[model samples]
Target chain A: MSLQASRNISRFWEWGRKIICVGRNYADHAKELKNAIPKEPVLFLKPPTAYVREGSPILVPLYTTNLHHEVELGVVIGKGGTAIPQSAAMEHVAGYALCLDMTARDIQDECKSKGLPWTMAKAFNTSCPISEFIPKERIPDPGKVNLWLKVNDQLRQSGCTSQMIFSVPYLISYISDFITLEEGDLILTGTPKGVSAVQQHDELQAGIEDIVTMRFTVDRQDH
Target chain B: MSLQASRNISRFWEWGRKIICVGRNYADHAKELKNAIPKEPVLFLKPPTAYVREGSPILVPLYTTNLHHEVELGVVIGKGGTAIPQSAAMEHVAGYALCLDMTARDIQDECKSKGLPWTMAKAFNTSCPISEFIPKERIPDPGKVNLWLKVNDQLRQSGCTSQMIFSVPYLISYISDFITLEEGDLILTGTPKGVSAVQQHDELQAGIEDIVTMRFTVDRQDH
Candidate 1:
């Protein structure tokens, strides 16, 4: 086999592609944050540098005191296109991963009130912690998976993908209508309700029910 | 020379690296928009998909009609680092480019009032139109250069880098403190005052003093 063909797709994160994120895609999440239901998908971005694998700890940025953990399902794109139709959105999927959208809540609140970008609150190093990639054949229905997270062995968040206000294909089409979805680009299908503060040295365990689970530790980042 | 060495720095955009942008970095710009002179640098990100080269027309997104043009200087990173000190920031520079931070003013206003992300307002396909890269040797003092933009032969924005609230090295240091500066990544120092809307087929001409000049036409995007 050629070098590329023999390689596993699990290492796709190393490609350094876009990490397009959906915000407030779940009605429960929107209600928890007191944000109104959106008429359309709200989007944001995190650079490739945000990705932290299983071994490394999610470092809470020194600038933020109240760090929050937002667990969500990550869809890895296999193909790339612009203005892609909703019907063909799934063909762009390569696989999936469980991801934590670590946020600095305090900073985000200030930015929100002041009408500022969430870069400091959301785009810091080790902000994204991801699980092992699950192939397409593993889960027949992505919309029905149960994503749960625990902090220090205490259940903190648990939600069904069916609770998403926008479906996977719809988000793909909506996002692609504006931002071009490229190969290896991972779309974070928004977080569920129950996003709360996570402290230093906190142990975080998250999983997509019946298929895969991953564990990570949180530590303070230093200068 | 190896395959890398032989390649010119101008091709850095093709590497698909992060495009970190500074906002309200110019005092005049802050005032023009009625925004406070920020105590520190305001930052944001534009994905690589936003880049549009010369000869390609900048497409106006169907979602907005009031597309404004803000011309700024682009810094291309040569070295990668985190928590980079301002003193050593200059050494990380590889070259520079003249770029337009095309924005949808109407959509941005709505996003701001709602305290939402600027992704839809700022990050769209062809949102960033850039000129060819200039090597580091060509511009020894980037802070002293002049940036001017003319729309359809009328001088709309005329300003100097000296008016920048945060200097180039300062921005590099600040941004790298949060977002790691990778080689091939870009940093768009904020634009000066005099930002306004442009209609379809309007010509945009921008340059850095007598160093480099680029022109592009605007066109409405179709579904």
Candidate 2:
């Protein structure tokens, strides 16, 4: 799709900043990707352009032929702070939502081979699709939550947040140690295993336990 | 260093929202990084938290035993717009500066192993050190500007923007295609060869041909 489709949704939450993501937070996903579970949290970024509403169509760019879908849980920042203690991180969270961290596996692979950056592969248009906000208080303990995603009603990924290698508090603490978290920011917890490529017209649905669900479709664009 | 050391540079002009970096933008760096020169631009992000102003103390984090410096010319966005044409790209530029894209090579390597996101390796605190602003009009042709960095009086990285894989306008056009450029956002046009590690207390000096020069020191703290 053309750049016109890339708009920042952060304004809705008063978040005028970046979306930080945690990678391989789940044990199964790490093993499936053939990566070792880290002792600490792993962090990454998804530019504002990547944010797409849950109902929007995910455009498949013509440049790369292999595009994949990664279903993740998104944490919206309610306040901005630095070096926040793990015990106090929950106070900073505004809400939660189900998100998809789409990737161009081929392009990312090439970049990895050359010791390069992953922005093009991760921060493209419609790369992230998120559900409406679910206030943090509703989730009680995010770590115990169950998340699942299905394509055309066929289950693709099903895992509980309990399987995450790093807990929510740890991620918040670790991230703040590196960068200051700001209002309207989002932290996309890594996806569980079952990430795979999708074709045009594929109907995707993702849900977080009894909390919320999101539905979307893939489309092909001329640009 | 503690979060207290995070200087509040909230002036929209002073705080760059995102630092878009181009990897393998230079042919030699592509070779040194052991990857083929990409047919298209390789993009990545270094968040605003990574930003360190001219003469700001760059604290070497304890987690990264091997931190390296990547000196490159920086492009500051003046006007924020999307789908900007190559011819009109310069109209959106605010200024230029000298910057260091600091990296935690070891952590980045680990991320490369598990196909993880590069945030921990790239978007760390004090990871970006930038010189004072030099308005775009000052440097008639940013593509031809010369950039270099020195540590404690020893020259480390020296290169010219002429060697870039994507010209300034092209980069602006390409980045805007997916990510919308905002006022105060910085685009780090990739680094040159001779990137190496530096120790605590080392002095770093970087500059662009005739525009801006910056001086800073490495800070080592117990925390």
> How would you encode candidate 2's per-residue C-alpha lDDT over B1-223 as one tens digit per residue?
3322332333333434678887778998878867678888877787777887765688777778888899988888878887788999999987877788898888877767656667777887788887767766789988788888898989988998899989999999988877778777888889989888888989988887656778989986345
Model 1 residue pairs with clashes: none
Pick out the ten consecutive residues of candidate 2 chain A with the lowest summed lDDT. A1-10
Off by over 4 Å in 1: A1-9, B1-8
User: Where does the lowest 10-residue lDDT sum fall in candidate 2 chain B?
Assistant: B2-11
Task: Report how far off residue A150 is in candidate 2 (Å).
Answer: 2.9
For every model in order, what is the number of clashing pairs?
0, 2
What is each candidate's DockQ, to 2 decimals? 0.53, 0.35
Q: Residue-wise lDDT of candidate 2 within A50-158, one digit each (tens)? A: 7788557998766667888888888888777888899999998878878898888888777666556677778877888888888878899988888999999999999
Report the TM-score of the second chain of model 2 against its true counterpart.
0.90
- Best candidate per DockQ, number? 1
lDDT of each structure?
Answer: 0.90, 0.79
